[model samples]
Target: MPDQVLELAGVAVLVCDPAGPPVTTTQDALDLIGAAFLGAEVVAVPASRLNEDFFSLGTGFAGEVMQKFVNYRLRLAVLGDISRHLAASSALRALVHESNRAGHVWFLPDLDALEARLTTPT
Candidate 1:
């Protein structure tokens, strides 16, 4: 399936296809960000679509990718459970906590959570 843009909770969201290519590099992330420019205020990517290095903060891939979205003024919602990654790294856990709190980059459990976040008053 191809990626699609949908309106959710009054926000235009570009929901990426899980079957599509994995986001492994900053260039790949930039591609997605560019795609989201089609009237999308947010980009929702499945956790499965992310490269393994994305969860390993030591590689700095996660920070780079996320910074791109922020720099472009686009919100990113990483959709799916990341318990194993969070459990392994204290720094990652802290990052998730802070990111979610900041409302720019969110590591959410699923689409429902993302919708809830969009609908909820901040």
Candidate 2:
């Protein structure tokens, strides 16, 4: 499937599919950011599209990728339920919570939630 780009309350969002290459590294994140540069302020990547290392806090993959996104000033919303991953790692759960609270990154359960969050006045 292809990536869908949409405008939610003037915020450009790139809704990516899980069928493509997994985004697990800083370079992968940079590539995704490049795609979003077409006019996207955010990239909504499904949880399934990420590598296993991304969920393992010790791997540092998530941190590296997210840092790249932050450096580029682009927001990221990891779409879908990652309950298993969260349950398995306390660090990751805290990471998700902190990221969501920070407003730059979020691990949401679905696209509807994503749209609602992005559309709401911040």
TM-score (all chains, Cα) for each model: 0.97, 0.93
| RMSD, every candidate, angstroms | 0.8, 1.2
Each model's lDDT:
0.94, 0.88
User: Between which residue pairs do clashes occur in model 2?
Assistant: none
After superposition, which runs of candidate 2 have C-alpha atoms over 4 Å from their true positions? none
Q: Tell me how many residue pairs clash in candidate 2.
A: 0
| Winning candidate number (lDDT) | 1
Q: What range of 10 consecutive residues in model 1 has the weakest lDDT sum?
A: 113-122
Instruction: Tell me how far the alpha carbon of residue 53 in candidate 2 is from the true structure, in angstroms, after superposition.
Output: 0.5
What is the TM-score of candidate 1?
A: 0.97
Best by TM-score: 1
lDDT of 1 by residue, 40-66 (tens): 999999999999999999999999999
